[model samples]
Target: MEETRRPRLAWKIFKLFLVVLLVAFIAAAGGVAYVWNELQPPHKGEMVSFTIPAGTSSRDIADTLETKGIVKNGSFFWLYLKYKGEGARFQAGEYEMTPGMTLNEVIGKLNRGETVKEETIHFTVPEGYTLEQVAKKLEEQNAVSATAFLQLADKPPTALSEVLAGPLPTDNQVRHKLEGYLFPETYEMKKGSTAEDIMERMAEELKNKLSAIPDFDSRLKARGLTLHELLTVASLVEKESAVKEESPMIAGVIYNRLKAKMRLEIDATVQYALPEYKERLFEADLKTESPYNTYLHDGLPPGPIANPGLDSIEAALSPKDSKYLFYVTKKDGSRTHLFAETYEQHLKNIEESKKTAK
Candidate 1:
């Protein structure tokens, strides 16, 4: 009986020893892994640029950094962040990383939001540019693709709905939602901004500037015109009058023609209807059947012919009181025009303009 008890005790001791060995081995392995993850660099002396967009998760950030070869292991990085109680503290932006950084070092940089500087570009949208022309201008600056910009202009972004109407017409027939809404001005934007982003910026600017005008909405209501109609007329005014001071006079001429129930006979509308704008319109251009052709269609064109400046918009809102119904650009070096009420006076001005041209 003693001999059997001694052997059983020895077997129990052996079993305890094996358990201790297993525990020690696991602990040692865990310690080694922790040290390796903390001290080991993912790569040696290689720099990479990584972008962390807004609202990205820790796991997704880890995965992105890992995929970019900026970090060795996403799982380990995630675990480290969780252990450090920094799982939710990562900042969003473009970050520059070097492979020589350890796990702790990478976390420190991301936590501090030490991101790379953003690349920005500058561009100017001149007044009187048509939607197509604006798109072409942005494309020339490498800010956006002309095709993408034009498509977006026709449909526009939803964010602009508060300031402007939908694609469907309200009181006036319009071609595109952003024809006159893309307020022309100099602008700066990040290099990778989408065309939609750029359009939204311009639309926001238009909304802000329009809001600053005293009684802008009340004035539009008094004119018996919607904002769309006002902009349409303003665009025509912009294209017709090169001299800033003549903007109000040009607006007056347009209003007088509309009230007289006569064709506008404005050459700028013919230019808008044609495939390409020209310095001078031929007789055939006047016969174009498009709704934008004021010679063929009465009143304001279906939509804005081009983007108008603030001066043109203000002129449309408060046109000069006048009986003048005609205007002819002088043939002399002056870009100003001659305005008259009767056909006889208009013809006389034309004759004088012709003589001046010679």
Candidate 2:
């Protein structure tokens, strides 16, 4: 009877141990389910936009995600990131997310820097555009205020003055102080950029481009041309040459005319002097009183007639060696010019151009 009592007691102790094990398993499973649910998104909702500024910590990012309703629980998200060793790789930028997005999806977007597309103002300033033209283009694109741009260009910020090779022209006759200094190129700026910002950026680009040339300063000195004068010649070449290959030749003609003390008589300058551009310049138009009218002026214009491209600027710095001093457009759809050494020859070329006109 004592042995039978001992066996029953041992069976009862073993059953109590099994019951405790089952209860513990159920509690562990319940904790895991709760944690898994918390790790998921809060609920279905519209997309939300947020910014993670540079230098924001991972824990702060998790909190922001929670505050933005991107995740169910900030603490849980922080714990998950620690467990996965992730959040350290997240990037900072503008982000768009929906509450229904999975944890993995949010993590993936942040890690990959899949930010929302930022609005940018994209514009292209054509190679020969004047400061006014640039202002108009900026206004057309809604990139900046045209009036503000022109005003800033008139008296650019002090910081921009450092980029110039020398001081701006003191000649009041100069049409615009920053006319040819603004490098012509396609630009993409943030939507809210100010006029001064754009002008500085373009001027800096011009400085950088000039710095890239080999022996640029020595070359300018050898030509006996100041930075302002060089740009003037380059703008003339840019306006005159329809075919890019002819730029050097056109520059040479101008140089030769200058050496001979002959008038530049550039049509583009006359056009610039006019109230507006005209397809054809009559004798009356050539007589416009502005100093920019090379036909009326005895030497180079007060300043550049327009902004010029690198090729035109290079051509002005190093012109082709030529005896030719006059040129007339072919007008034969070839967009070329007939160069001549004498006025008589130039007259003949003019007749030839007329014959070839479409």
Candidate 3:
């Protein structure tokens, strides 16, 4: 009986030794693998972000991370994750990885499932640009292809009118295109974005700017302008005055023209007639017939030429009291206008400013 007890004790000791050896082997192997991985140079690809979806297997993730240069070896990464019982913890979404990222950093990114938003470049769409004008500006940056962005404007269905409402006519006619709606402001857009994307952002900016104004809707209505037409008129006022102080006065000039059934000979209106703005407005430029030339036609042009700012909008709303029929802007930032309850006095102011200019 004593001999039998000794054998049992020996057997128990042997089994403990085997267990210890196995644990030590595992620990050494893990340590060697970690050291080897650390010694390996990062073979990760260019610095760019990528997406990993949820429920991805270790093998698939390893492959994807490898493609993005997040991992040097897929098999090793997969094996490591499985051995550490981390396979089930791998989250998926978007992630940015770089050659500079350590294996540990890659693992952290995967476990956290970081989502990366696309980087975007920005440009400001200035106040007082028509869709055509806006498109041209965008073209200069190689952002979008054409001025066709204006074609998507809100209008009653004439080709584009079917798509969006265009400029609102003075007699309460709504347009099918979006001539007056794209708000002017800075925007961030992905490279190679479509004109549609560009237009949508502008429209969104327009909505944002409009929402901030008090009683904006009523003001638009009272002015007998839709949001689109109001923008058109506002753009005119914005371009006409460099000084904010004179916006209301210039607005009064615009109003006087409308009231007197006279032409608004604003240089800004002439500028809108052509795609390339001429530095000087000539008598010939005034006579040129485009939907935008206020000199050739009587009422506000079919639509706004440029996106107008709040200064212009306020001027449109709160036009100052003036009997002025017309006004000429001066180089010194001053202005001269023809005011007339009488025709004689109106002509006198024009001839006087012209002679003084000479």
Candidate 4:
């Protein structure tokens, strides 16, 4: 009886051992499959930048990877991603993946945000942007407060004094604070920068761009432009001419008008005074007074009409030579104008314009 029991027990132990071996072999096979697939291409290596559309399922993404050759086999990626508990972690967006990247590395990028560090803080301050114009541009981005930008322009930083040798003139009641020195261009800013920082960067860029202006200081002196006049003329140029090539002629016009002691009757100056350049002006709007009236006050208005561009600056330095002491826009709105040195000729142009309008 004892011998029979021993034999039976031994058989039972043998069966248990076989079961253990079977489990071990299955696990080994799985490991081998996983390793074997890793050596192959994702599919065939077609994807450099992969876009996973929104709402893609695990199987769908794996299939896409397989079709693109980004994975040698989709089954392995599926199993691997699932085992790592990353099935739902694959973000939907543009992704760049490579064969050199391990399954773990690719998953990590997706989980962290399929998005590399990026910024959207890009906008421009046009060559002729006034403090108000700048404020409106910034307001569109929400990077800084427009009100704050405008207020700062009214009281430019003392630190800026080192840069703006000829800022806007303060004596003129018509002129506001630092309008012209803002220097217009596109600026990149942090998503959440302070208004002061925005102002400083703009000021710094302005100084740099303007510094390259040859004999800018001497030109400022000759024009009696207390930094203020430069800004004013710059503003005028910015407002008057869209073509950089025409800036010199525009500057010459400003110079000629000043030379003749003529009223620089620029509509832009009127617009500046009204702070509503966007609206169409009636004759009454032109007649209003707030210091920026170039028609009434004469002598270059109170301040810059807009933020002047580099062309305006260059134009101010090198005005075009002409006998034109007066210019009036033609009725065609084709930029055709009448240039007159005599009052009778100028009056004749005005009468012609009225007849055309009638």
- Ten residues in sequence with the least summed lDDT for candidate 4: 38-47
Q: What is the C-alpha lDDT of each candidate?
A: 0.84, 0.92, 0.70, 0.73
Model 3 residue 153 CA deviation (Å) reads 5.9
- What does candidate 1 score on TM? 0.68
Candidates 1 and 3 compared: the better one by lDDT is 1
Per-residue C-alpha lDDT of model 2 across residues 44-160, encoded as one tens digit per residue: 999899999989999999999999999989999999999999998899999999998988999999999999888888899999999999999999988898999999888877888
Q: What's the true lDDT of residue 269 in model 3? A: 76
Give me the overall lDDT of model 1: 0.84
lDDT of 4 at 74: 80
Q: Of the pair 2 and 3, which is ahead by TM-score?
A: 2
Where model 4 places Cα greater than 4 Å from the true spot, the runs are 1-120, 163-168, 172-175, 222-224, 331-333, 350-358
Could you tell which candidate, 3 or 4, scores higher by lDDT? 4
TM-scores, one per candidate: 0.68, 0.80, 0.61, 0.61
lDDT of model 2, residue 283: 89
Q: Report RMSD (Å) for each prediction in the order shown.
A: 7.8, 4.2, 6.7, 11.5
lDDT, candidate 4, 130-171, per-residue tens: 777788778887877888877777777677666564544666
Top TM-score model: 2
Using alpha carbons, what is the TM-score of model 4? 0.61
Q: Give the per-residue lDDT digits (tens) of candidate 1, residues 1-358.
A: 9999999999999999999999999999999887677546775767888799999999999899778887777877787788888858789998888787777788888889998877899999999998899889889988899999998877765665765532325534466668888789999899999998888888778778788899887888888888778888999999888999999999999999899999988888888788887877788778998888888887778788888989999999999999999989899979889889999999999998988883
Model 2: lDDT to the true structure: 0.92
